[model samples]
Target: MTAALFGHDGPWTEEEYLALGETRQRVELFDGSLHVTPAPTPRHQRIARRLGNVLEPAAEAAGLELLEAVNVRLRPDRIPIPDVVITGPIDLDQVNIDAADVRLICEIVSPGNAATDRVLKMHYYAEARIPWYLLVEQETGSLHLYREKNGHHVEESTAAPGGLLELTEPVHVAIRPERLLD
Candidate 1:
């Protein structure tokens, strides 16, 4: 695996970093290191869109906000672009306006990213103390909903075509398993 690169430490501000322009691939900064991710595949986009379709209506009804493929600052100089992110309704300034303020994060695993999402990203999200993390695996048509329990991650529920997923408390966003594959 190629090592991620961190920008040289200096007086560079967040606005300066965010304003930097690039016309190539998507890049992320984790601990001041640059991590370049491969372009998402068509199947990846399909799964992400399907998830949004189900959640958007429910979120709207609950007065929540839906952000898609947006860079969420998880820590200072560290940002990870979740496939689907949901937070409480708020003005732009009150939301994830910088490198923090993300409540729930989701990632749709593509071919090469399956292992990394399962291991690296999984641990990253857990360590970040995100209340809820959702993982959708296209190959198995599986949806794994993880809730933070006892300061660790517990697979609260798994749903496939025949199963029904319950969001439980808090966000209370639920959708049928098959809808995720649509």
Candidate 2:
């Protein structure tokens, strides 16, 4: 499904979206809706990159890998490009991702995505049974961590700019929230 809606007639698939490269906006498909996102501000990129720097090496040491802004296949036909994802046996090495292969999914919230990140995406990720999901809010400089439980997402913890987000499995990494604001 490479058909994506740009304005009136879209909902393009990944291939179609890529074909129209260099657009000022980035779009992702979630629950069949075309989510058009604004270009990342420098602040957003900085935070995303900083988080990657902190987590990537640790994931590798644990026999896992990290992917940035990669499309994850949550179902046979549903894909949501998350800001950061960590999993074992990296497949993007081949240039495409099999979403079911994802272990953890993270998103750094933008102004347009506060509701989606905190609510809609939360349900979707929970249903997919992703072991862990992190939501980083740039405006608040906080991180919200959720872990799947009995087919639902249970809020595991929340950390502020100077606070620590501790995890027990996959890599045992603790994040410094300020890293997400950089």
Q: In lDDT terms, which candidate is top? A: 2
In candidate 2, what are the lDDT values of residues 1-182, reduced to their tens digit?
23434354644555554445444566666654567777788877788889899888889888888888766777754667788889878645553466556778888888866888888888888888888898998888989888889878898899998899987766778998976675
Worst 10 residues of 2 by lDDT: 1-10
Candidate 2 versus the native: TM-score?
Answer: 0.84
Per-residue lDDT of model 1, residues 1-182, tens digit only: 22212444554344544655442455665665566777788778887888888887777777777778776766676666788988765566532434234567789888776876787677777777778888888888888899876656789889887887788544666767677675
Span of ten consecutive residues with least summed lDDT in model 1: 1-10
Give candidate 2 misplaced runs (Cα > 4 Å): 1-24, 93-96
lDDT (Cα atoms) of all candidates against the true structure: 0.71, 0.76
